[model samples]
Target chain A: MKLRALAHSRTGDKGNTSNISVIAFDPANYERLRREVTAERVKTYFAGIVKGDVVRYELPKVSALNFVMTETLGGGVTRSLALDMHGKSLSSALLDLDIPEGEE
Target chain B: MKTIRIGSGAGYSGDRIEPAVELAEKGEIDYLVFECLAERTIALAQQAKMKNPNAGFDPLLEPRMRAVLATCKAKGIKIVTNMGAANPLAGARKTAEIAKSLGLTGLKIAAVGGDDVIEAIRETPWPLVESGGSTTDLGNRIVSANAYVGTASLVEALASGADVVITGRAADPALFMAPLIHEFGWAMDDWDKLGKGTVVGHMLECAGQVTGGYFADPGVKDVENLARLGFPIGEVSEDGTLIVTKVPGSGGKVTAQTAKEQLLYELHDPKNYFQPDVVADFSEVEIEEIGPDRVRVTGGTGHPKTATLKVSVGYVDSYIGEGQISYAGPGAVARGKLALEIVKERLALMQVKTTELRFDLIGVDALHGPRLSAASEPYEVRARVTGRTDTLAEAVRIGNEVETLYTNGPAGGGGAFKSAREIVAVQSVLLPRDKVAGTVQIVEA
Candidate 1:
């Protein structure tokens, strides 16, 4: 199963840092997200794209995990040569993460 | 049980006006907030103001005000916005003139300013958070440096009997929180209430974002009538409880999922979401689907705020030169690749001093690149070449190199477009809160 099946995400950027929020569609999947979507796993998941450290913050009540990726926008919106200047599509990239079957 | 209904009118500067008009006319909101400024918008507006003293606010300011002013005034709904961009005083005066022109009299408009810290920055050049270098490193290229202020001045303006509040570079959440503070008389240091109010403000600040406009994914996260997506209206109580919903009969859904997604949008750390008024903590916040299109959000906690305020510093980063041309028919992919290679070699031959460059195939790997996009032959591909250079002349050559591909190489290439412009980059810095004092000026029509 892909993370997209169990979660929906939104990405926001400032300077060169991108903050991506992955919220579970079902509250039952929150624990799975907590276990699988570690900051290290997320950093490895976006290996080539994100250059800086990845920090994950847990919001148990909201069943969401916020992953903040630094130095990811190439050079931020104003300077980035990428088409998606704000890294808005990064959420889609993150949603493509694979989760084992029966995990959901 | 006293609740204040605040509606988000516009998210960004060029956001849709009709939705805002809908929010004003039908949403029955006490305050309509328009978060019209982005990080770099004010800097660009400063440049525009330098060129024309009268033209620094949002381009749609006049039209948006005209469209919503009468109805809002008639309904006794107050307006709060950072549409003032680089010049709040001018924006307020312009808005006042518009009200007078509309034959609406006795409209009180307040412009809160003193966010601009360029002079102070010049006196004591602080190091930017992005680059540890001092502001002096950017030299005269620096355009604008405005610190994000809080709800103090805005609350004062609202309390001064002003119907509309115009501001420059105030924190986005503050635009929504000011009315809450003023209405509920929330003590400025009341961290818990401020945190809860900030949560509501953050959710509604992006307008349609939380109401299914940005949440829609066909088949997966299905959202209804996204095109006519209704903006969000937050019903906040004196004790900081909030119910997020949209106007009845309007399009879009405001589910707990949407509210939860928005709760973390642009948020770095849920434990410490920094705002001038409070260090908001959303980690303990709860969202429940109390009803259809209504989510009850509560339990947002907070700590004392930091002494320094974040300042958005804008400077001339560099010049960007870009060119795009479409290649169609049998070997479009091959031709697009060849076009890109030719532009690359041509830029080298022309001695274009590029700091960084990107060559992309729009129909293929422009977005995710080869990582996500599987290599496939498309019938048509748009070849785009972009580069950043220190000088405008060098930047122009980058696009000129690509434009040369029109006659130099590639087959069936057409619809060529080229552009070169200076890149005004923005970064954040922290300045002592006491250094940048804010003031409110009221204009009556």
Candidate 2:
């Protein structure tokens, strides 16, 4: 199952770092997200765009996983030549990542 | 325990004023915060201030104040804003003048400043937060440097009997956190309480984001009345428990999902979310949908704050030149590609001194490149070329090359538009807390 099947995401940028949050639609799938949506997987997913490391922070209360990607965004918003300098569209792209469905 | 109600008026400089008016009139709030300054906004304002002595504040300040000042004054609801972009004194003076014209009496507006620490920063050799480059490297290109001050000065201003507080470059969450401190008398050193308050403030800082304004999708998320999306209001208690909601009759809803999305918006680390007052820890925070349009946020912790404050340093980075031309009907992708190729060749021939450039087909590969997009040709495409150059002449040439494509290449290319703009980029550096001092003075009309 795609990450979008169980979650919605939003992207924010500071300097060249892009922070994307993926929140589970249902808390039952939080464990599935925690298991499959690893930083390594996310780094591989955005292999070409993100130049540096990716770190994931977990929030079980909100059932959300925040992926902070360093050296992304083509540089910061004001300096970047990319069409979406802030990387706001990156969240939707991350939602396309596939994960195994968990039994309820 | 007593609780104070606070409303978020304007989220950004261009945010809608109608919702703010609704928040002031019907929200029954004690404080209304307007967060208008972006990272690079003040740098641009600094340029404007250089041109005109009294023109560095938010452009819509008067209009927004005109729309809400009367109701806010009548309801005894104080306002705190960072709309004083590059000039808080001028912003305070303008607010005072606006109040007098509106026949408002006893309206005390205060401006808190001393956040501009360019001179102080120049004395020290500090490395920037992102690039780790020395500050002296930028030299004459540096426009402004503002340290993100905390809520202490703002709290002092509120206590000094001011009805409105205008600030230049205080941290965003500090605006919301000040009211909680002022009303609850929460100790500045109380990390837990400050952390909880920061959570509420961060959630409301974006105004409509927490209230389902930006959470909508056509079918997947499905938020209603997003067109007239209502701003957020928080009922915060002395213990730092908060319930985020909106005006009852207003548009937009506050659900747990919305709260969760906002909770992590721009959040780098949940455990070490740094603010000037405290390094808040939202890792253990919890959100519960207590009622319709009411989400309860609690359980935020905090650690000791760093001795240094983060300063936003703005410099003249480059000039951005852009051009967009659309191609429709059959073979639009090929025409768009051809248009891009022509611009590339022209730019190389002209020897435009550009550091970087992008060629995007908007309908197809603007964002994802060709990797994610379909291999089949697109029926409609908009060819966009953006280049970054040091000189305006070089930048203009890049855009001019794209505009020339209408006649030179690519059949059916229409709606050719071009623009060249100076890019003011910003980076962060740490400055000792003692180097920057904040002062608050009430200006009366």
Candidate 3:
């Protein structure tokens, strides 16, 4: 199953860094997100697009995970020549992450 | 609990004016805030000021004031904004003129200045946060340097009985937080309250975003009436409790889902979201839907602020040249690829010197690149070629190469568009809190 089935995400950019938040639709699914969505996996998930390290911060109270990816945005909004300069669509791309079916 | 209602009018400079007018006329709010400055907006405004001294503020400031001033005044709703981009004094004067022209008297407009620290930056070089270089490296290329001043001067402006407060380069949350401090008499050193207030400000700073404006996902997360999406109003109490909602019968819904999405938007570390006022902690913040369109927020706290304030330094980075053309019908994907190849070859043939270049198919790989794009090809695709160059002449040739594809390369290509523009990039540095002073000047109508 895709992560989109259990969660939603939004992307925000500052300088060359991009912060993406993934929130669980059901609070019960938050633990599943925390267990499956590791920083190493996320960094690999965005292999070509994100050039630097990815750090994930868990918001347990809110049932969300904030991933701060550095050296993204193609050099920041003001200087990036990319069509989606702010990397706004990157959140939608992360929703395509595959989550394992069934319980662990 | 003595609660105050504050409406978020405009999120950015180009945000919709009608929603703000709606807030002023019928939102039944006491204070209305418009967070209009982006990272690079002030830098562009500085450029505009160089051309015309009186024209550094938000261009829509006049129209926005003209639309909401009378209504806001009639309802006794105080207006606060960073629409004063690079020049708040000029912004205040213009607002005063508009108020006087509208026959509204006894209106006090205050402008907070002293955020401009370019002179100080010139005097003593600060280490750049992103580039790991000193301010001296940029030298003459630097266009503007404005420190992110906090809520002190804004609180002072409100306390002076000013109906409207304008500032340049203020922290976005400070615009919303200042009112809470002034209305509730929250001490400047109250870290916990300031943190909660920062949460409220962060939620309301983007206006309609906390509503259903940006959270719509077809079939998955459905949002209704987005066309008439109403901006948010924070019902805040003295002790820093907040309920995020919208005007009754207005567009968009306020639920825990929307609140949670906004809570983490643009946030890096949830444990320490830094602001000029306080280092807020949203780690334990709670969101619950108390009513149909109200989400109660609590559990926000903060620590004392850092010794230094972040300053945004804007400089001429480079020039960007871009061109796009659409290809449709049977072999659109192949033709689009051919178009990109031709432009790449043409740029090389023309000896175009570019630091960076990109060839993208709009529908297929424009956003996520080819790795993540779908395997199947689309019937229609727009080929885009973009490059960054030191000189404007070199930048212009990148687009010229793409435009030639209409006649020289692709078949059935249409809608060729090209543009060349200078890039004003922003970097940050930290200035000691004591080095920057904020002062407010009031203008009466």
Quantify all predictions' global Cα lDDT against the true fold: 0.90, 0.91, 0.94
lDDT of 3 at B395: 87
lDDT by residue for model 3 (B1-445), tens: 8899999998899999988888888888999999999999999999999999999999999999999999999999999999999999999999999998898999999999989999898898889998688999988899999999999999999999999999999999999999999999999899999999999999999998899879999999999999899999999999999999998878998999999989999999998999998999999999999989999999999999999999999999999999999999899999999999999998988899999999999999999988999989798999999999998988888888888887898798999999999999999999998889999899998
Q: Model 1: per-residue lDDT, tens digit, B305-369?
A: 99999999899999999999999889889899999989888888878888899999999988877
DockQ of 1: 0.87
List candidate 2 segments past 4 Å from native: A101-103
Residue-wise C-alpha lDDT for candidate 2, range A1-104, written one tens digit per residue: 78888899999888899999999999998988898899999998888888999999988888899999999988887789888889999888888888776565
In candidate 2 the C-alpha lDDT for residue B75 amounts to 91
Error (Å) of candidate 1 at residue B206 is 0.2
Interface RMSD of 2: 0.9
Ranking by DockQ: 3, 1, 2
Q: Which parts of model 3 have CA positions greater than 4 angstroms off? A: none
Per-residue lDDT, model 1, residue B289, is 89
Better of 1 and 3 by DockQ: 3
Candidate 3 C-alpha lDDT tens digits along A1-104:
99999999888889999999999999999999999999999999999888989999999999999999999989888889899999999999999999999973
